[model samples]
Target: MNRSVYLASTLLICGATFAQAAPITAISELSMSHSFIINGGSEPAGIEIDTEPNSLTQSADATSQVDRPGFTPTDTSDVQVGNSFSDPPTPFEAQRTNSQTNLGNGDVATASYDVSILVENDPDIGNAEEDPIRRAVERSGIAAVSNAADPINAEAASSFTNTRDYRFTNTTDDAISFNIVGQFEAEMRAEHNGPEGFARTSGSFEMLFETGPGVDITYFPVAPYLITVDEDDPGASVAEMFFADDGAIAGVTFSGGASAIADGTQVEASLTAQTRYVFSITLEGGASMLLETAFTQVNAVQVAVPTATPVPLPASLPLLLAGLGGVAVLRRRRG
Candidate 1:
């Protein structure tokens, strides 16, 4: 019999014999590593998966190229650039054990696995640090003040660029082996530069999979951008939001007046902004079978800070200011 046919027949017989079988306690661990660069920065990333309670852990470390050029190894807070710049990669590890009881069958089976993922930034590892333009750009009073108020300056901004890496592994004791894996990878670049604005760019890639030796498959989700809304206000203008997968505007819109979201608009809304909304997506036949389940909803909102007035300074503010300034200078030098 063909391998596929044989495997199918074996599974059918196993299913019948073990229809009501209970699974014995088993332990499993999973780890993954993935690496990718953003703009011009290197970052290390990884994820861990556990089976007992079924949970996943993911993390990333990133540093920008702009900050490295002037960075020194002795500078604990600074990241070095050029050939000397390197991001310390992080590893993810997980462990789990479970005992499953079959509702109707008497068959007993046990299966376990370990998976890992790692991501890293390479390619633009070393480069010179110079302003993009030969001359300094002009700034208005508002722009100057905004730049000064920025917690992360141009030098500190680069540190945000991060590289990613991922890896996964599985181990099983049962005669029948089964595993599920999926990934959605996309590279995005900011077309505009501002603290709060819309940026746009485009790229292409493919999603491939292998169930086992010789069992491989590939498919495109077509319109990759499945959902789009004001990251700040999902209820904002539907016209401002676009669903790439369908390229249909009717797929996403809100009754609110936030109709025209510019390319770089920042979304900030609270649950109290408005009632929650829901959107659903259905994939094509084959795609749907490959990726079961479709409908998902965007419900509720989270607001971190409340709107309030600034407190006024008292008459003795000058003395307090002088003392604070002295303390700040001392901390900086020591820091």
Candidate 2:
């Protein structure tokens, strides 16, 4: 009694915002990723469970003189799973923080910065039957500025969110099915130097493939697919956007901008499916006010699960030589 046993769950969200001015330099970055792999000879054998619970936060702040007197400002924050211990496994190396501020020469001086992360999950079981498991996550944001003389202001912001749930059943009895190949990416960068310097970046993504239960699940489309961009924007007050969504094969949206000098944008997508899947991404960015200097960076999300190749057969085999010439002409008319 096997009815193709396979279940999965995941939910991710993101947010961002940054502004700059005064000998300004601005940078904004973002990231969100997901990966999956199933083995047992494609499916049907048995055990295949996964688990990943996470929640992370990162922060950085800088402020310049509020009127007089030094007033050096810089703030930092790091949180793991709402506190109380017992939840931390996603840092895998890549927790960053930066803040800088100076107020002395000019008149209006200021500097601001931000970075954020959020991950949520529950329901995990391990045992991929025998190898074949990969999971990933990335959250980023960066802001930079140079050329200050009072009349200074700067800001940076970043965000992240992660969630996971996967289960594949079939303790024998046969009957199982699962296959998924994936890819998602987005990146942006900007630089400015006068004419009110400015920079911008944005993001939105979603993926869903389901069946049965809770509000009746049903989604299609997950077949031969490919969308490209890989990098664009040479300058000239640049601007860019990426899109995807035609019912089911769902999710994809990105934005870019430039003013006074630099620009950057990157995008990519490739997918294939045979069942359970869920995805999400959200991002934002901005830069403003700059007498001469600005920089901004943004990364929407990058997810990959490469490993699914087996689609060849068309070298003019002509239906296997016409079924071997009809079994040798029926064995030469039975000799």
Candidate 3:
């Protein structure tokens, strides 16, 4: 699934002596996409379902025109969008919640904070998933025709946290082989191109899948799982985790620039007859950008596998089971 959201346009102005004609600009953007696929069974042809893809976007732009005439007027603006949905027996559930704040003062400066969270889950069984993307940017500079006398400085920070909790059960009377496969990609970039201006960006991300009882993994900054990009440095990182026995194995990678780091892995879980298993995914990341007349952003996507839980029983299942029991009793008496 592919999704993109863009928002925010504003101009900041202040009282200052027109010593030079300079147009200073500050901008920050952040977005994320996620996808999940469910398929696979022990014997019978595997079944698969696709979750409907949903997207949300928010944005703001700030510019300072101290000496240039005929420039766009300094106007403050903000935009927001959010939605959430839940339907039982539906293959998809998603929610987008966001909040933003922008500030400006006497100086030719701007600051903004944005937060957005995406969640999906199966409620009846307490299997929940939540993904949140957060970013903060602050830019300060004087409008000067020459960088020798005035300079522009801007800094942006971003973080991501995602949790996937699943409960798998074997309804059959005999043990069965259940498997899951995951495809993951994580990418990040921060760049700057201007005379006498420099740019630097860095970030760290990790993903992990664990098995146990009551394994509730909620919270940010979970142990680094995917990749970490250091300040002013650009590169990629690879990491993996495995469950014991026929359990599944998965991996994810991170890289700088627009190119995405991709990986694929499969996990086979040995589900005991008439037993339940709890598994979870804990993913986290943090990024920073510093530049002049430059931009920074991060993108992370994951294609999750299936959760093998029995389908809902039909309304007549009870009567049918009772009838079968009576027939068995009659057979025993005849024998």
Please report the candidate that would top TM-score against the real structure.
Answer: 3
lDDT of 3 at 240: 18
lDDT of 3 by residue, 1-335 (tens): 11211221222132122224332222222332222222221221221112113312223232322332222233433333322234422222222212121222222322222323222333322212221111112211111111111333322222222222232333334333323322223332222221222111112121223333322232222233343432221211212121212223122212122211111111111100011122222211111111001112222111112224423223222112122222222222211
For model 1, give the 10-residue run with minimal summed lDDT.
136-145
What's the distance in Å from true for residue 95, model 3? Answer: 12
| RMSD (Å) per prediction | 27.3, 21.2, 23.0
Best by lDDT: 2
lDDT for each residue of candidate 1 in 1-335, tens digit (9 for 90 to 100): 12213322332354445434321111011111112122223121211211112112222121211111222221112222322133533222221211122223321121111222232333243222111101011100000001111112221111011111112222222122122222222111111122322211111111111122322222232233332233244222221122212322111111111111122223221110111112222222122111111111111111111124423223222112122222222222211
Over the full model, what C-alpha lDDT does candidate 2 score relative to the true structure? 0.28
Write down the TM-score for model 1. 0.19
What is the Å distance of residue 91 in model 3 from its true position? Answer: 14
lDDT digits (tens) for residues 1-335 of candidate 2: 01000000000000011223333332222232333333312432353332312311222333222333453555554543221122642323223333333344322222222222222222132222111233333333433333333222333333332223233333444333344333344343334332222333333223232222211222223432333222233322333333333342233222333222222122211111122232321111111110010012232111111124523223222112122222222222211
For all predicted structures, in order, the TM-scores are: 0.19, 0.32, 0.33
Off by over 4 Å in 2: 1-22, 31-45, 50-75, 82-97, 103-140, 146-175, 179-187, 194-335
